[model samples]
Target chain A: MSDEPVRRQVTLANPNGLHLSPISALVKEAMNHEAELLISFDGNIANAKSTMELMLLGATCGAVLSVEATGVDAEVAAEAAVRLLSEP
Target chain B: MQVRSGIPVSPGVVVGPTLVLGSENFRIPRKFVSRDVVESEMVRFHNALDKVCQDIEDHEILVGEQLGSQYAAIFSAHLQMARDPRMVGQVEDAIRNQSNSPEYAVSRTLRKFAEQMQNLGNQYLAERALDIFDLEKRLLRELLGESREELSNLTEPVVILAHDLTPGETAMLNTDYVLGFATEVGGHTSHTAILAGALEIPAVVGLGRCLAGVSGGETVILDGDHGQVVIDPDEATMERFRTSQARNIRVSERLATLETLESETLDGQRVQIFGNIEFPQEVEQCVKRGADGVGLYRTEFLYLGGNKEPTESDHYEAYKQVLSTCGDRPVVIRTLDIGADKVPARIRDRFAESQNPMLGLRSIRLSLQSTPLFKVQLRAILRAAVHGNVRIMFPLVSSLLEFRQAKMILMDVMEDLEDENIEFARDIPIGMMVEVPSAVMLIEEFAREVDFFSIGTNDLIQYTLACDRSDPSVANLYRSGDPSILRMIQAVLKAGEQYGKPVTVCGQMSSDPRFVPLLLGLGLRQISATPHSIPRLKEVVRNISIPEAERIATHACSLDLARDVEHYLLGELGRLCPDLVV
Candidate 1:
């Protein structure tokens, strides 16, 4: 499989921001796809599949961030991250 | 006569004729189906799914308006999942293998997945099973041409009897006519039970198959305190229950008039009566009941009401609303009391999974640990304090050092705001709830530093009894009337006396009228309860003399055991007013 990187801008709809529950949701989605996923905001980057890393990002509500993934499932990972961010 | 028993989820003795709410699920035979028949069943299933989706969509507008868009997302997801092609493929495969109608096949397949998900043991994944089954059931009902059963509107009070109740269904109940509830399928921890407890309605759950035998309009006696449903009772049982119901009605009516009247003892001692509120809507109830002010405005509701952590603006708006409603009346805003069980959808991430959450990171402990979250809530409350007579309070302050540390953080936040040229109240009195046993043990030290004390008896009793209030098996052990609980109350009251600081009981026990005289007797001059209970508590307070109450309290304290003290108080209560028994 060809490895590629793709990124998308998403806004956190959850009020708790990038807290444990949403981070868990995002991590689960990232784990489902065969891709290396990462999210960045305010010059800080975190592995999308690592709850501890995502939480350290301190992404609060209404924060705009970019989720990027590389590998065969990068496109699907990007799409799923966008979906997670868009979820209420 | 048949009597069935289960766990009582709410306290209250309600007696009324039974109103059996029957749901007729359509039986679609599982047999080999021809291609043509499968096609028709598929169309029916889709039609049903569409209708249910439309129903959810309709509710979305209403619920969205109240709880905001986040809650509406649950339905939005459901709508999308209903039409997911993967689910469609699964349903088709099931129908082909079983030769059943599309709706039956879908329901059975979803049930299977739900069972499998249950065994997986992930809460997030397991919760999704309900959505799948709910959608399938909706589709099957529609395909089978069965309408959702609507609860009957009874002009007379009646006990609700159903096989099971959905959270939404229980939410829609008319509180006025529904005396109590009994269900056959749910346990004490079920959604129905939780909702019932929130509603403060008497409810009994997990009675097994006995619900099927109950007929509509049967003179059923639902003892919510014991979770016993008595059908076709003899005259004596009927009379006893009727009298209890009459007493309940009479007490409520008497309390209703107390809101507007000054809460002065018969000897003319003025006492302050405040209401404990969880939401802004309760302010109206407080006003109608003539509450002097809000003693404990639990600020956690702003966090708990939705999935996301409330913004500073959200916190400010809610605080402003409550403060504005109170006008000059003092409103003590307690900081977040979030624990493992009580964490709102918002800000739950800050907490780690604690094996013993009650003793874990929560209340002032959690607040002090996180400066950012603590400061945001503090700044918002301080700003709102400028709008009205708002006071700031902290929960679970186990030590004097913790109290000082919290105050230091508040001072830091205030200084930062001052540097920004933002306005806030710096002179607001800071108080702490004396819920933790350690706090109570050292009330004198705590009283010396804090401006006030609000005794949270619910947790006090729970911690003292070492019982989880939600645990049915040990629920009997958790009683505020226990001598140990009364002793703690007395200790706190005396500490307030020594320190000359205002003390208030602002827990579930405060709303309980039976305890009002006892609280007054214990020299507790300030009581805060729910808005609905404020008037009744006021009535009880107004009827007795402070000296008499003090005498009773002294007598109560003299008892060697908690049970004996409770017995003495109950006997005194009976002698005081036989008609007041509820």
Candidate 2:
């Protein structure tokens, strides 16, 4: 288990960013990990495992957000979030 | 997964999609549940959640099949949001602590979250917030649909689940689309129940608690025979339902084959079997059943439920519908016979309240008193008479003078139409209902002036035996097979025989297969009963010879007590067709 939060900055390459599908996909992926996942954009932070909260971030095309994960699977959880959000 | 027990008012098994009708606009019927129902309400809430989750899963599969799996991912999000502890937790807390009804708890919790999403003020996000509102509608539809007020706009065939139905609402139901109906609160004789029987729609009523666990559009199994409503029945129950339905269809097909058969005895004595209908829509039922004609088209319904007297067109169109449906077949229209208490609301107070409304100013007496209202219906019957064979009969004519006076009013209406030179059947046959004891006592004198005689056995037995038929305690005394009733019917038949006019027995007794042979033996060449009973009555009529029926009636009439007569008649019917007695 990691004590320090693993963080990565990612830009959404997909044309529709943090929209209904992507936000839902991120939540589904984030729920797979035993870690606390958070995605922050424009000073608005949302729990990566919550679809409504993640959607409320309202990130648009090419929007840059920070993905942070902390727990046993922090590394893979952050990597999954970054990879899912960066999908074109 | 929800089941409700109600009184099955109409007999049939209905497995179809449901359209629930009740309170709308998140207007919870009861905002709060009592402490006792709180646990039940909470359980009800979970059931709704489970139902909604299954629906979202179904959409996922369907959408995934049509488009790619990614396109179906949105429903997955909805599924998650529905189970989200934040939403469902709050809903449960409200139901548990505040005693809110499950419907109210869900509405409050979801609306709060939906409003939060909407208030975010981002165009893209606000539009996506519609997903939340859609989810809310899904939950409500799982519990119950919108109001009964929206029922008129139904464009598809669906069963109805409702809290209750008013007489007007039940009367106006379209038999074409509304396959069956069940209600949360109502008795065996409620409007929904009686009208369901009259309209031949499967129905269950008096479900003490319902609609809370159901949302609209679910496949419902309304077992009107057992008065059970099972929502989302298991595969096993559905399999049983299908097998029984197949057997029922076989029986129906056999009866349907009888549709084209004649109502004749082995000796070839022909009888005319007509339908007694309350609504014009039932004329199609009569035609399908091969009824001779509509022998009793009850016209009081046009007035009873409404605030004002039915306009001339309302009366005309209904008669026109029935007559045109019958084509050249005779359609007998009974004029307004509603008791003064049951008259249209506008003129209801005008008549003095009678102590015993049944014996009071009712039927021909009420019509004679309210000539203006009575004349409107008579004119319509005359105008629509040109459409097909239309005979006008006055209901509950207790005296010859009352019969003649009703004729005088009919003649007056005829003259008014004549002076205006409007088109109508000038020679429409006029008759009196042989229902009251006096009507039978003076049958010969009254039989001469009237063109025909139809023994209305229901009221005749009620008045003859001096018992209220609806009173359960005295139900035995209100026997239809009472000796006095048979003798009265015999007298009417004899009068018709002497006057050379046709006579038809039109009542519940005529519909009973047990009474069919007895009626035939009493020399009733024709009868009119509800459309539902005509098929079986025809089957019974076909199986028995006139001589057999004559023997049954003679033996029944010779019996000492009403009990002996009824017992003997049932034995005779059982002997005729072992399947019918049970």
- Best candidate, DockQ-wise? 2
- Residue B13, candidate 1: alpha-carbon lDDT: 76
Best by lDDT: 2
Going through the candidates in order, their DockQ values are 0.02, 0.26
Every candidate's lDDT: 0.74, 0.80
Clashes of 2: 6
Question: Which stretches in model 2 have alpha-carbon errors above 4 Å?
Answer: A1-88, B1-10, B13-101, B104-164, B174-194, B203-246, B304-308, B471-477, B560-568, B578-582
Evaluated against the true structure, the overall lDDT of model 2 is 0.80
Q: For candidate 2, lDDT tens digit of each residue in B222-254?
A: 898778999889899999899888877776777
Writing each residue's lDDT as its tens digit, candidate 1 over A14-42 gives 87676546765677677788888889988
What's the distance in Å from true for residue B160, model 2?
6.6
- How would the docking of model 1 be graded? incorrect
Quote the lDDT for B294 in model 2: 92
lDDT of 1 by residue, B150-240 (tens): 4643466777888777655676677888888888766553445655754667888877656433335557888876678887788988888
